[model samples]
Target chain A: MADARRYCTLPSPFPMKRGGALHGARVAYETWGTLNAARDNAILVLTGLSPSAHMMSGAEDPSPGWWEGMAGPGKAIDTDRWFVICVNSLGSDKGSTCPASTNPATGEAYRLDFPELSLEDVANAAHVVVRELGIARLACLVGCSMGGMAALAYMLLHPDTVRAHVSVDTAPQAQPFAIAIRSLQREAIRLDPQWANGGYDIHGDGERYPDMGMSIARKLGVITYRSAMEWNGRFARIRLDAEQREEQPFGFEFQVESYLEGHARRFVRSFDPNSYLYLSRASDWFDIAEYGGGSVMEGLKRIRIERALVIGVSTDILFPLEQQEQIAAGLEAAGANVDFVALDSPQGHDAFLVDIENYSRAIGGFLAKL
Target chain B: MADARRYCTLPSPFPMKRGGALHGARVAYETWGTLNAARDNAILVLTGLSPSAHMMSGAEDPSPGWWEGMAGPGKAIDTDRWFVICVNSLGSDKGSTCPASTNPATGEAYRLDFPELSLEDVANAAHVVVRELGIARLACLVGCSMGGMAALAYMLLHPDTVRAHVSVDTAPQAQPFAIAIRSLQREAIRLDPQWANGGYDIHGDGERYPDMGMSIARKLGVITYRSAMEWNGRFARIRLDAEQREEQPFGFEFQVESYLEGHARRFVRSFDPNSYLYLSRASDWFDIAEYGGGSVMEGLKRIRIERALVIGVSTDILFPLEQQEQIAAGLEAAGANVDFVALDSPQGHDAFLVDIENYSRAIGGFLAKL
Candidate 1:
């Protein structure tokens, strides 16, 4: 059912400015389905802020992919047909080179010891995976949110290697609003008394870590995970269970309190606070103009790719429709065959995950054309 | 030289549901300028998240009131002329009836033991203050953000008390997105290990204090304080001085880290975490429609206020221009004279504080007309 275990490292065409030393990165990934006879059926699907090979098909570990809802046997992704490959990114929360992992220079969890990581480095790591897969060119590349930026990065780094691109609900560059929000969450995590300068052994004994801080971060994440309308419909001063919640005698009688507490707890246990910090910072540093030859239009001009499908959501404030237009306009200006779809949804920023019906139709239609 | 303590309190028309027992309560406040012979010069200005009765005045305390910027000699509020009063609302961090106040039955801090607070309670509290002041009616009423909602609440509760209203960057309802954000901050405090179920003394020096939770809550607050543009321009990737900032061997070498840390530390020390939770919930629970018979428009139709000013910030995602237009159009439909101004800024929601020039001009012009 799956052919896996193709790993590779590449020397970055771009350099990391934060660190004095040249950065060489390795990418670990898996391949599914099969390359068509002409090798033209290759599709690239990128993952988001955290997670690893877990973006797609799971192995003996048997954990489901992050896109379990959208990518399956009869799902929009249709793994039964198009060849798909997902890679573990560099500087990630999972089993890849990240701040939480042992640093090469010194054999210890990087903690606050990791070098300042940039999006360029992360994209470069994916580039290594792409080359090792030997696809030569991709039929279509689709990404969501942070992963969407990586797809654009792939198109930017190796212009000739992609035939079509789909950056769904993504930004051309990092907005100050996103940065402000992320910065606040990171500050929340690091400010915890138990964080102890990021040298935390959270898994060991109930010895308090930044548990409260981690929970707070997750609560913020949950706020961004869904649309404003969805939250309104589900919770409006719905009081939390007085007996089960974390308040003292006669404390917060409202339900919203535990909702946030549960949300933060779920994420904190699964994610590394340092990786969250690095990845969020990397995303903030991502600006197409800075990395894409001083302008995104110029970056696309260099692309020899022929086709692109730019999908956007009307209510996505994080990656408003305008940013997707920028990419489509650039690709069209470069004489590429580009299709644009600005779908409507109440889900802000995260329409890709929630608006399944419309998203599936868009995905199915785009793939059928290929 | 300034005047002596002239602050006073007024009993509410309704009983407070904030604390367990139905204890009759009052709100404390101070007024500047003078009431006209007809008491038509009376203008009510509501305070923000945390402040005292001395809002808009040079008080006995060393620190100026929270709204000192908009209300002083020759300022937009023009305290030298109109009789402007600022009341410390019920369930406030300031010395008013709140969770921190002694419960008549228990004689202990309400802590998490207080009953749920609603906009009606806040409005009811203000009603008492207005009645006690012997100001038969108000010429105009103005509020920003949380206070803006309170102003609307007052209009709904007592149509005869005020002749006009002004709501700057606020909504008649707290959308789910607003509730979600507030919930995160609340959980951050409640989840703190040292919280000891909401009974921990804020001034206690034991390591068991929940400063960690307070710090996290403050960090989240800082995020909402200003626009993402401010963070990008002011703190983007800049590194703090080695001697001044907390030294991390690597990773967080950015100046934003230091800025957030210092900011969070100050917030925790100055504000109580539980108070933060209560006020934030109050903001989320604010909804005029729920109180004024379901339809937000119906709520306004009952308001006999004659004049109103609705202000919105162009860049404020929290309170966009659309929300302001809704306020303006509603008041106009109700046959009330309303002035709506949209101030442009890159500061997102906090433009109310940063864009002083235009705000001052608008407020001054409005005050002069009255």
Candidate 2:
């Protein structure tokens, strides 16, 4: 089992988010398995939203993913075989350096003083971590949704460091729909009164911003992570209390509303509001074309990868089947060895998380070919 | 300008939104055109989300819609001829009986005490006004979106009163996607501290809820109302301010963001927040089949209309062309003379509001034949 001891901090040569640069803003990350002598056996995993470097992979995994079943020892990202490394993304709340992280210079958390981070800035920090980990070359870069997005950024910024990019249910181009949905979630957080215009260090004034804000934001993410068809099938607009058939008397007595609410409350416990905001904005800002001066092909042509696998779910409306095709097309245009396998599952964007057997087999074969 | 010269206090026959049953709920409304000798030239144009009884036609220079150029003299509605009657809908901020309207008992605003109105409830309220106005039969019943939805409910309830029923951009059923979208808007309002649990008396404590919440909600509305292609063409991530030239900042930096915020602000000024919630919920809860014991076509068959025109916009992603097609199919199945028109427009869900020339000509022709 991979433990927290694998975590390492690589300081950024950039400023604090709120203000002046931190001569070297530290990026805390972790690595799993052993790097081969050729250093080509390494795989980098970028965290989604607020996930720390510990995108866990082990035998008796106590706490699976946040992607638990997907990236385990005998899973899609075969931890027992391939050396996996995940970085606690910069501007995240989990064990990483972010607003909530205490500023060494000021002896206080950066809070409002935290520097504003774009996807580029976040990627730069991850680049430094990969470089400092003594893995000059890599076999693949894999991630999901936002993490998948960060992986895209990693490939673009550190093109020479990796051999291949394997995106799980991700598109190189940020579609308008995804951007729109992500903006809604970001607005939900930024609009909170206690977010205090991005201030409030101590969670203070006996007025901690309501946890419901983050909860609501997470529910928004959950909706996007899956398809409407999935919700329709899984839940029958069921009321929370079956016995109390009060009908639609006055308020939201339906089970669906209660179901969404419960989902929201759980997100409040494990995730940080600011990290969610940062990561969401990062995903929305993801554009390989933007990085390449309006040519996605030009951007990808720079990638020197031996193999690439683009995986997506059938009913995953968020990622969609077409998006995976686009990713494969982009890689093929770049003359990279690209193979796209459409995972037939109704889990929507979350098929990678739920459909273990299929994903694990596909991942194993992809890695074996590499 | 038209004004209601004579009005009477009336009790609502339905149960109050809070606990007690509301009686004598005064309905305020207005009429256009001269009553014929036979007293049957009335064409009821039901108001949608924000418009007042003043879905104005011949007011001075002819006020642009609250339908935004859709209904006007010589337009599809043709206030120049047909007796146009548009009321401030029940549960609206307009001069209709709503949350903000004064409660007879306490003389205070009904606010939260306003019942969670169903589409039927809204239609019934309009029903009372139509009967009181001395119109034995309507020449045509026309509604758009939520109002369009209300028209269907009205046709179901008072089939004898409506001669030709036209429902534009209305859903035959509430898909989870639609319901979830509406719920997202409601959550935005409820989460706002100033909402004060919907008990915020509009005139209370200077602690007024930021109409900003409603504005944001409506801004979200504006996004759904129009097409992304249209948005990209009109305001392609263009910076709203000089500062945003380098990056896509939050708030109203992008022209699109400014466009959304403008809509939100305008909506808050003219619309009731609580009504927005109730109406949105009503729109989400609208299931013609669910209401009619699982047979929407059976319900439509009962509505005896001379002729009807169902209009759908090709680019209307929100209302969608499918919904309009469904309306026509249902009406045709019901043995009604129905002509269906699908207008090609880039206006998306708000094609009815934006594509005035095409809509006017099409609707005008339809009305002439009817």
- Top candidate, metric lDDT: 1
Each candidate's DockQ score against the native complex?
Answer: 0.41, 0.25
* TM-score, every prediction: 0.84, 0.87
By DockQ, the best candidate is 1
Which candidate achieves the best TM-score against the true structure? 2
Native-structure RMSD, model 2: 4.1
lDDT of 1 by residue, B1-370 (tens): 5532343444433454444333645566777787778777888877667666776546444356666688877898886788887777667766666766666668777777667776667767777777777788888887778878888888877777887777877877776566666666666667676777777775545566678777666666666666555665776545557676545422344566556567776666566556667777778767666755777777666677777878888766566577688788888888888898887776766676667777788878877877
**Candidate 2: residue B153 lDDT (0-100):** 80
